[model samples]
Target: MINVNEVVETNEMIEKENLDVRTITLGISLLDCISSDLEQLNKNIYNKIYEAAKDLVATGEQISREFGIPIVNKRISVTPIALIGGAACRTKEDFASIAQTLDKVAKAVGVNFIGGYSALVSKGMTPADKLLIESIPLALSTTDVVCSSINVGSTKTGINMDAVRLMGTIVKETAEATKENDSLGCAKLVVFCNAPDDNPFMAGAFHGVTEADKIINVGVSGPGVVKTALEKVRGESFEILCETIKKTAFKVTRVGQLVAREASERLGVPFGIIDLSLAPTPAIGDSVADILHEIGVEHAGAPGTTAALALLNDQVKKGGVMASSYVGGLSGAFIPVSEDQGMINAVEAGALTLEKLEAMTCVCSVGLDMIAIPGDTRDTTIAGIIADEMAIGMINQKTTAVRLIPVIGKGVGETVEFGGLLGYAPIMPVNQFSCDAFVDRGGRIPAPVHSFKN
Candidate 1:
């Protein structure tokens, strides 16, 4: 039972701070909707998602109003289309049709985004995986509300350089395809390694085949709540600071647990998990980088940033695990430059660099997210970056992703405005050094020896 003090505190978090449920994602598996006929397959896919998610937006609004908790976005994630659509979608155009169907259903159902236009080739690519990878640029550019992802590596199997190389070109094509919108399509495509099965976030979220036929996963956001709490404990010892973060995270996760259970019950679906990620927003108060600053770092890219982030990420999980039993998904701090004002400021001030961000992802939940690079950046260079991040996840046995946007026609020092949640950012310059030879070696990087844990 939530006490009056708890309720009052939660209300304060919502009112004063930027506390809110970041997303209520309905995970709908599309394996059962597969067919050999393209048109039939699309029909089945549309009906399945539209029917399953029909009540999603309304239910989210109802929960927000009744509970006084703001549910920011209602979204959906389907099974990897490459697994099921290969039988029907033979060409890139066919895959675009499926993307169109997804976009149409998402709009019809009133959801903000529908994920799972994805392929998973951690070790090697199948014919289907290749098709999906090749179709990513066309599919994402031709549709709205449809997001895509590809997982090219895992701890169990090393990085697939073939897929990595291909995706670099695909990402460039996506930028070119959506150049009219400031390369917004690149924002909707994420390349991940060790991608979680139950992530409730967009672009990277997908209803893994291992998941239930249908489930509800909620991502809780409260960077402002955490930042506000830390303000009081400023200049305190690390022990005191960790305690403050733990307690704050505990309260935040509690709200998420309640919302997840309520949503599951009302939607008549099983509750998946509460992703207690301190997801930041473009809003002033809701910045994860500010938390780093509060932790005594001058800025997010300062010398102590990585250590500060390490402490924050670990304490968040420690505080969150006790608050809910079904804790899954990437449950830590996300440092998306476009979405976090502090991060944007750090970058603009030249305090943060791409290399610094790479090191930071080593300890954080995700890696180098929402970064905009110069348009003419080499595809080989992009592949090299993805390979490095994948190596981190593979070695650390944790999830790491790269959501890089090569803003077409934009170079360093120029800001691209992707209004709303996809905030504007100064295009960060990349190393002009060539990695063509390294990326050109199209072979798999072998798994680590420690993978023999079984």
Candidate 2:
């Protein structure tokens, strides 16, 4: 059934476009690692993860050479630490100790990052969830290669403003703790609403309790391929543009499908899902903002930008779903400012604002990401920003998240460089107003009536 032209076309997409598999994540359950003894808990945690993911990187590399597909990152995700640690950890330091174990094992296994240093407190914080939240600043600062996330809201649970208020302070503390490193620790932390269980992406990926004991998830990304394909129809109608993108996305996801199955087979792990997220990087032409431009935006934050993004996101799913039977994770286009140079330029040119970016998230995959705020920006203001985005995800019944960095000792008009895939960003200003009273209410924003569909 395989054809020569299909192979040729895929090769073109890979060689010319920046088409690549963004990540191949191994999701491992750690519920078995729970124990009352802190030392034994850390040991179990380390041994379990290292054993599960020991061959992941080597397997990925071997597959890449065989298929000529670039598998960008080999990563891992475990059960939320709070759930298991609740039974073991007596204090915040205990949680950080677990984070250290995660970091150490991640490096040993050659994984770029290990996720699930997380707490799910959508409805409200359990004592363990609160402990993990309190430990995040220290946990992230003290460790490398470990990412953290907290789910503060969900459609079924509404918004947890109590967690929101606390996360604002935690986000600030994380940045402050890593100020010597340009507040890089915040880059590894994400706060979300309706977080997905099967996400292969970092800072948000965690092995949901419902998943299998071991599974492999693949994230495919190709914004450059899409933008390049659009060149054939420079002045074409919207219908033609949509068709072109769908076809390009099809090629992108097909590569991911091939890689995921290959990796799974080689490693003896079951394939979970193919995340069709068009993850961009600092590399030129691999920008989602450029895709918006190719979709006919003068620049990213223009009048018709949101509409253009909505079309791109919808068509990508349409094309991707046809290519893979199982599609999960944040599959829409990502507009990470630091990672996408076009996004950074949009901000510099004033084509993008914090508010405009928020609107774009309504139509895109994940919400406000890699945005830098002024050091003087109030913690309450950060909480207010997260609350607004959470409200969107809650009302729309979709996943949205915030990974904001309050650049310490740096104000607006200044810049901070995180290097590597996490490039650099200008500190965008936030509203001066206060929402202290509203956020300080310390209660849940009840789930919508539509969420009662059960």
RMSD of 1: 0.7
**Stretches of candidate 1 exceeding 4 Å from the true structure:** none
Candidate 2 lDDT over residue span 227-337, tens digit each: 999978988999999999888888899999999999888889999999999999998999999888887888899999999999999999999999999999999899889
The reply for model 2, stretches above 4 Å from the true place, is none
TM-score of each: 0.99, 0.99
- What TM-score would candidate 1 get against the native? 0.99
Worst 10 residues of 2 by lDDT: 290-299
- How many collisions per candidate? 0, 0
lDDT of 1 at 384: 92
